[model samples]
Structures are given as structure tokens and as C-alpha cells.
Target: MKTKTALVTGASSGIGRDIAMILSKKGYRIIMVARRENRLLELAEKLPGESRIIAADLSRAEECFELYEKVRGEHIHVLINCAGFGILGEFEQIPLGKELEMLDVNIRAVHILTKLFLADFTAQDSGYILNVASTAGLMPGGPLMASYYASKAYVTNLTIAINQELHSAESRVYVGALCPGPVDTEFNDVANSDFAVSAMSSKKCASIAVRQMFRRKMLIVPGFSNQFFVFAARFLPRRAVIATAEKIQSMKREEQNS
Candidate 1:
């Protein structure tokens, strides 16, 4: 059997990094992508199998296109769109430029890469694409972190639609969305937010995500509580869901201010 290769974005830290490590241990060569070249180099050294590093800022459209070009021929058996960040603040209060950047990474990047690779994978009739979304996307809306939540919702819904398309076509190409809740990673630090609930370790989150990806799960919501939240949201009134998200995000803002 030919050795499989996986391309993982946002691999410098957090769930992306953990998934890379896990894939390496599973004997898949990982092509790590992130803006932090030094961090990628360090992770490459630790991997049990072969690895390559591509340092690119995924927020830029050209960079996202270029990234796909760089690795498409490598026969990547899996593509993990794990490169994304969120900001916590009132929708209007946050700088528009920053929100755009976040959307570029969280929405645009994921959209572009998924579109390009889905074509390739569908043509070959074999591959897996795991998009790292969030439980924030599952809810109706978020209050303080409105833009961030909306960005994730785009990812989640996009993945859902794509999965439906692939299934309708009876295609073997697998596409899934990993909608994990607050993970104990550098995410909160970078997003300038606080977790209202205890954060799960990145290792645990990655383990579940990768495992579910292999199992062909459409929506890989990690924790039981998170699964429940997503399910419960469907039955709750839209306004109530928004209000709950408001309380959670409001706590994050309060913590940041303190």
C-alpha cells in the first residue's frame, strides 16, 4: 500500500498540532501549514513519520490558492482545514478589518480549500476532508461574539450541504465538520476571550475528531455535552438560543475587562 499523506493547516498549535502528531503516529506523512514557520519546524522534528512544513498566512486569498497548488499533486489522502481564529466583542465594536481577517481565515480559506480539494478528491473517488468548525456554529446566533459565531455557522452549514451533495452522488469522497466546543488551546488567548465552561484538552478533541473522520461521521461534535447543546438548540426558540449565547459571550467579555 502506498503511504498516505495528510495536509493540515493551522498546525503550529492547538487541535491542528495534536492531530498532526496523532496522524504521524498512525504512519501518515503530514504536510503542516501555518504562518509560524519556526513552530512548524519544531513540530516536524517531533513527528514519528515523515513531514513537510509550509508557512503561509491562510487569510490571504492568493496564499490559500497557492497552498492548494503546492500540495495537490502530493496525493494528499486527507485535508484538515484547521486554520481559523475568532474574536470576542460586540459585532459593531470590533474593528471591521479584524473581522474580515477572521472571516477570511474562518470562512474564505475553508471555502476555497474545500472547493478545490473536493474536486480533486471526487475525481479520484477517494479522500477525506475534515473541517474544524465549532459548536458556536450550531447555535442560532451569538451576542458579543456575533461575527465569530456566524463564521463558524457558515463552515458547519457548508460542510452539511457538501456532504449531502456527495451522498446524493453516491461518491466515496468523505467530507465532515468537526464542531468541538471550547478547547484547551491557545484559541482563547488568541481570540481574547474566556471559556464559560471547562475547556477540553486539544489532544482529546483531536483524538475524537480524527477517529470520527475515519468513521465517516458527517458532523463530529466531540463531547457529549456539546452534542447535547447542538441537539437542544434545535428544539429551543431562536431567541432563547441567542440569549444563551449572549450570556456565554458576555462572560468572556467580563473576564477580559477584569
Candidate 2:
């Protein structure tokens, strides 16, 4: 069988970039999407297999439609929604517009693109959808990072629903949610989420996520420690989890300041 094409959003950096590279190495033709045209072009040039650089802000609803149109005519075997960011600090302190943008990118974009591609996938009876959520989505977040957590929670639930629907119908379509802990990426710096110790690398996280995805796992939490924390959060008191997260966030901020 000919290798299928893969579309990865946020393909310019972090986990998204690594995913595109990994899928390409596996002989898939890759379509890289992000707002940075230059970075996407650079990635396209370096990939072993054929790659297309799509420069579009997927945060916009119309752009999501355009993206679907661009690849709808082609054979897309997978869609990876990894274009997301967090704004740290108290919700009231964060700019309203930036928070809304986060919702647009993390939540709305995922929904719209998935809806568009799902129709195609159902018709063909095969495709994979990977939504990059976070460990924060597993629980109620701390004082800071409220909106970010809420958005991820939405992703987690939505991914689960789709996965359930696929399984119920005995379809080959697969959907997985990647709930990783803190990652060592430009995401931290951009979100200003400086911490005492950085988490795993984007490459490592991407590798684990992709592996689980191939296994058709409905959800994946990469690190042992992260899995432990999420498991505890599930049974522990909500206030306790919130307090722990606050302390961790505070320690990170203090370390950055020092």
C-alpha cells in the first residue's frame, strides 16, 4: 500500500515539529501547517519524504475550512492538532484577547478541523486524529493557567467522545488525546511559565505519543511521574490538587526570578 499523507498543525516547533518529522521518516507524505511560513518551509525542505508547507493561522474558523479544502482533495491519513499555547498568571491578569485566542486555537480549531476531516474519514472508514491536550486537563488547574486548563479539559473530553463513537461503530477511524506534562519547548518561554525544573523534551514526548497513537490507544500520558500525578488527581481531593499545582507554579516562578 502507498504511504498516506499526514497533516500536522503547529509544525514549526515543539511536539508538532517532531511529529511531522517522525511521520515523514515513516514514509508518510507530510503537510505542515502553522502561522510561520519560513519555519514550515524549512521543515519541508528537511523532511525525507514529500512535504507541503501551509501558512495559515488555524486559530481562525475560516482558515480551518481553508485548510480542510487544501488537503481534502488529497489523501490525508492523519490529522494532528498540536497548535496550542498557555498564558500563565491569574486569569484576570492575562489579556482578554490573548485568552480568547487560546480558546480559538486550542478548542475551536480542533473541533472545526476534526469535524471537517471526520466526514472524509467516515466515508473512507480509516484515519487517525491526535489532539494534543495536557496533564492539566486531567484536573482542575491552579489559580494561574485557569483558561488553559479549561481549554485542554475540553480537548480531552471531546477526543474521548470521538474515540467512543468510532469504537461503538466498529470503525477503523482512530482518535487519541495526548496529555503530556510540562515540555521543554519554546512554549514555556512564550507562555512565561518558567519553572524550577523543566519537563521532558518535545522529541521524547512526541516519540511516546506517536508510538501510542500507532497502537490505537485512546489516550496517552507519556511520563511515569505525570501518569502518577494524574492518577492521584483523579482520586485525591480537588482542593489538594489545586494547592499542589499552585506550589509548583510558585516554585517555578521563584526559580526564574532568582
Which has the greatest TM-score?
A: 1
Compute each candidate's TM-score over C-alphas: 0.98, 0.97
Query: What are the per-model numbers of colliding residue pairs?
Result: 0, 1
The sequence of per-residue lDDT tens digits that candidate 1 reaches over residues 1-258 is 778999999999999999999999999999999999999999999999999999999999999999998887897999999999998887778999999999999999999999999999999999999999999888888888889899999999999999999999999999999999989999989989888778899999999999999999999999988889989999999999899999998888777678
The digit string of per-residue lDDT tens for model 2 on 83-145 reads 999888888889999999999999999999888898899999999999999998888876677
What's model 1's lDDT at 97? Answer: 95
Best by lDDT: 1
Judge candidate 2 against the unseen true structure and give its global Cα lDDT, from 0 to 1.
Answer: 0.90
Model 2 sits at a Cα RMSD from the real structure of 1.2
Model 2 regions lying over 4 Å from their true place: none
